[model samples]
Target: MTVNSANARIFGSDADAIYLAPIGTPLPTGIDSVLDPAFEDVGWLHSDGITEAFTGSKTEIRGHQGARVVRTRIETPGTTIGFHALESKAQTKGLRYDEKEVTVANGVRRTRRGAGQKVSARSVVVDVFDADDITVKERHVIERFEIVPDGDRVFTNSDIAGFPFLGEIIGDYITFESSGLATDTVWNVSVTGTPTGGTYALSVNDFSTAPLVYNAAASAVAAALNALAGVTGLSGITATGTSPTVITFPSAVTLAANGSALTGGTDPDAVASTTP
Candidate 1:
């Protein structure tokens, strides 16, 4: 392969997030800004981030002709995810010890470990964000897994308390669903009459574009809208065409009363699935 600098990319792990749901829950078919209510965000994790491990045993077959290995077979395939939680909430404690929290008082909660307690399995979803663009990300789904404590638990005032956890893969190990930038919301702008120079505003957030001439160029209008200040969640907005200039937004937005609303915008679809 030839070396290509354009294809090389570096990533950072700061914006990654993890979510947990009941085992056998249905996976989402499309990517959205917010996840379903069934999945609970795992909150802050250790700075070391999440780690994945694969383990298996292999057997080799030898041929009698030349005393050489001919074939090999893999047995006992396994996969696991390791991570440390920085929060000591009830949900985190429950996952670490396969126990539920029992309320003792208004602000007091406790968890007890008993003999022959079976570990609980959960569906895990890990969302990894792109360093360059946080909107683009990859969602890793594990159908069923058990969370086991990876190290001894020590509570002390001298150091920060961290809970180490290991997720054991049970069945249908992992699936990756990737998404690109969100669809852009569009609108067609039409100017009528002999109106003087003025600014155009969006009805949704009251975001107004810079001053524009009576019949300004589409590119100029796009540049003015893109330069709007104090607006949130309206990135990569653009404008095209001459008379009925079309404006596109990075995400959904409401058009002002003077323009025609742009349509045909949809969120990115999940690229992979493990189950129906």
Candidate 2:
């Protein structure tokens, strides 16, 4: 969620609905902005998984050829969100990209398939203290800062654990820029246990594809797993992850399956079923 000091509190404890506004459009006082809002009088945002998305042009040309004019037009997209969380959180003192520290034989930081995108992962210093770490929560001004995305690190000179630093400021609101671009529907499936070493077939959205052949090696499994991105019917589906790779499909897809001659590996599960 991109932060805006709008002083709005959406999804209150008793709220059965939400409000949405266009990008760059300011919402009313105490109202929050959702990803895609209705341009007509307020439309309903569903809590269920069903929706109707326009697949064609929403606006047409007007007047005759000599005096024709077309202003703004809305085109149908491939996917839509029935429900989404418009807000997110970042702990003042947690790891970047949420990587957990573990003690391996040589202090090497290895993560499971659930570790999140490696591009955003970084090691950090424990410079700040938490409430449990100290008796006082800083009775003074307990400074707050707006976090800059893709900027410098935070808490640089303070002897904190995670550093180099994304600089810090003194404020309560952290405003992040937002783009109206759409995101993909993704799911991560971990192939665990010993590989029986054989061919595995995959099925997506009821369309079956060729079998994926691999050995017991982890690298081999990861390679073959990612190759599913090119399947004919898989359209916008993309396969990612290592050890436990994720396959991101178009939001319209509802099912994906892996049937391999290999043994001991678990069936692919939705990314929601696993933590990242």
Candidate 3:
């Protein structure tokens, strides 16, 4: 049996956060854009964690002659998010009581609920943190949803106040966007013959390095390549290994052979995603 630890990933909600905006507010352009000013962070949540529920109904089609179900059809597929806000602020309260009227007088906040009121749809963005608990791993965006209170508010000395609410997806369902991870370009640099002390030049992406000795160490070659000026994309390129020195770039880029001085360069794969 073989085990691969590289495929394992553990995610926690320690640094997770929820953001809410008006229905017409634009969704985040990318995972890094979740912090736009249009969205309001709902603050801390209960340790129970956020729940995403996908529900659907299935119907079986039966034939009278065979008396057996042949096909099954799904119906009313829906999605909802459940969370308990630990903060007792206006944002959470407004979500819980969508029809409540709020006013502030002398720095005193008051909310009043009215009869025969309707809940309004809102755009929600849920940020899930990575194992580091700081970087965003995945961003779940709901274009339009209605916040429905769980109608249960618990206030006790033993536990903190939790304002439970459910987000009923009204328009589009959840669209997931993840942070892009770029793989560095790598090249194997090999020296063919032993040179009796002569200077050689290395060129990468049209940028040439300063004069380097023919018998220079891999580390020295890496330093000379990294020290190349006037090219921003070529910065941070590294080299390692002996004979066939391995070079890596910060991003996918075209590599020049420098008249066969550097060879066997490979570009990183392109990032692609699809919407459901």
Candidate 4:
């Protein structure tokens, strides 16, 4: 009698697919798979039983239909596993365990460079917790702690020690508007509080169009002046305003070669305006 062993083949005449290895085996390498393991461990099976199932569909990729496989492993008492897709093919796909922890001991801190540093969707949010209390100490972004980086800087609890306590750091909040620009015209402006008591030059004509309106010209002038890196050095000086007709500085600025006060009527349509 011929006996079938481990390679026994059993199929009906109308079999549509072939079954290979037993369940729970890792699939072959070529198959695309995503895996997100538990925070610290894996294989935390339910106390009851395991329910395994798989479904397939034809999804459109580019212009052609591609077969997509979705497999689900459900544990009793309802624990749904989540899987994160691998970034590239070079990396192996499998469960990802995130059980890392951070210790904090200083004031939870963050920094901002300028007025443009506003929290947005992509911003990384950190939450600090008191070690013994298990209560949340603070929830904030890096901006609330400091201002102006010489170049690029990272706001991290790891940088400081003592006081803040060992805590958790959660990340990446919702999205927001990153950048944009609005162009307007400014006809008149006044600048004051220069580091050196000398004339500083500004000209709005280069940004002006023909037959410029008074208010638009003022906006352009204010925006141009505020854009200068040196403008921040002029302590007590104000060169920006929403009212577009006139740009006012904290002090008087010379408009022409005669050292006249920079004002609306005296605003020259030339490229060189000076502040003293």
Candidate 4 residues lying further than 4 Å off, grouped into runs, are: 1-217, 235-244, 256-276
**Model 4 lDDT per residue over 82-112, tens place:** 1122121111111111113323347542222
Segments in model 1 whose C-alpha atoms lie over 4 Å from true places = 4-12, 98-101, 115-118, 133-136, 156-159, 173-234, 241-276
lDDT of each: 0.63, 0.33, 0.66, 0.25
Model 1, C-alpha of 32: deviation from truth (Å):
3.7
Q: Residue 264 CA error for candidate 2 (Å)?
A: 6.9
Q: What's the TM-score of every candidate structure?
A: 0.63, 0.25, 0.60, 0.15
Clashing pairs in 3: none
- Residue-level lDDT tens digits of model 3 in 78-184: 88788888898877777666445678999998878764435657888887765642322667788887887765787789888778888788765555533324566
lDDT of 2 by residue, 123-181 (tens): 11111112222211111111222222222333457532222213232323222221212
Cα miss at 119, model 1 (Å)?
Answer: 1.8
Give the Cα RMSD of candidate 1: 9.3
Tens digits of per-residue lDDT, candidate 1, 1-276, equal 789453333444565778888976776543333445788878888878788888778989999989899999988889888888888887677766645446567777765665433466788888676666555556677788788778766789975588888888887744543334366666766664434444333333454554455466878877777777644335667777755677776765545533222212232111111111
Minimal lDDT window, size 10, model 2: 133-142
